[model samples]
Target: MRAAVVTVGDELLSGDTVDTNASWLCNRLDERGVSVERITTVPDRIADIARVINEYRAEYDAVLVTGGVGPTHDDMTMDGVATAFGREVVHSEAAEEWLVEHTDYAAADLTEGTTHLPAGARMLPNPEGVAPGAALDRVYVLPGVPGEMKAMFEEVAEEFEGDHTHVEVVRTAEPESALIDRIETVREEFDVTVGSYPGDDVRLKLTAGDPETAAAAAAWLRERVDPA
Candidate 1:
């Protein structure tokens, strides 16, 4: 399946916080044979979050969102997701029970916003933190904190399944200018994407339909361009 990632945080946009969630989620999805189509970082604004979620949900098979699940004022991801899906936000009893049983804090410690989830959404357990995540349709709303996001993702990893192709990189002495025509030819011949990066050295990346296709492309590239 192809997935889109949304990282919601003003800190991420301002460079105050690194977007580790996107990278980690992408890697995890890749291991499960899922492709990440796009990743976006946005502020805590509800309208922007809802717009992006709606747009990507219509385009991709799945959309994974991170951030804005905390108790603080800026935590608006859950509400935004509910708005995007045209659903109301409600407190999840299962999530409340999980928090009461697992965490050191009492139920009263959880802010009203922390327990609210999109209506009909499934709760994804977050052992690393108190706030639980929600899954509605193809959208998975996760906690912004790296620790909680990783834990929640691991708990629900088995629920997702998809197909993915492998990519192999080929570096050669030939400049990208010399290999542009050949790269285009290979792309047209095979069901794959060929990307060329030129800098101090030239690097060609072949993303093929499968492992065998990647091998064949690598061989073809090697035959045409000598490696440095």
Candidate 2:
């Protein structure tokens, strides 16, 4: 399956917070055989969040949203998600109960905003934090905090399964100039992708729909180039 990831937080846009959530989600999604087609970071604004969600949901099988899911004012992801589907933002008593039961917070400590969600959205329980994840149709809303996001995603990871892509890596001391012809030959001979990265040691990555294809492509290149 193909998916898109939208990370919401003004702090991410301002460079105050690094967007590790998107990378982590991408990796996790890939491991589950879901190819992430896009990664977008939006400020904590309802309009921007809704726009990206609306655009991405139409194109990908699923849209995974993270961040801006707290009780605070900047936490506008829920509202944005609601707006994207033209759904009403309703108070979820079930979510409130889940929050109360799962967390140390009392009902008195919570606000209507804390438990509010898009109407018909399914709650994804959070074992690590207060704000629970929500799933409405193809959109899955998750918390921005790394731990909370990871925990919440694990609960829904199975929904995104597809054919897995296998990767093979080759670390070589040969420069790009030395490997260009062989790389091109491998690309033409195999149904795989080859990426060359220049570093202290050149890194060659071969990826394909199956392990055998990737291994064959890597072997083709390794026959001509010396491994580091």
Per-candidate TM equals 0.89, 0.95
Give the clashing residue pairs of candidate 2, or none: none
Candidate 2 TM-score, C-alpha based: 0.95
Off by over 4 Å in 2: none
Report the Cα RMSD per candidate: 2.1, 1.3
Query: 1-228, model 2: which lDDT tens digit per residue?
Result: 999999999899899999999999999888988889899999889999999999998999999999999778889999999999999888888888997887888988886588888999998888888888899999999999999999998888888897888999988998877888888888899998888899998999898998899998888777878879
**In candidate 2, residue 33 scores what lDDT?**
86
lDDT of each: 0.87, 0.90
Report residue 212 deviation for candidate 1 (angstroms).
2.1
lDDT of 2 at 174: 85
184 in model 2: Cα distance from truth in Å? 1.6
Query: Which pairs clash inside model 1?
Result: none
Compare the candidates by TM-score and give the number of the best one.
Answer: 2
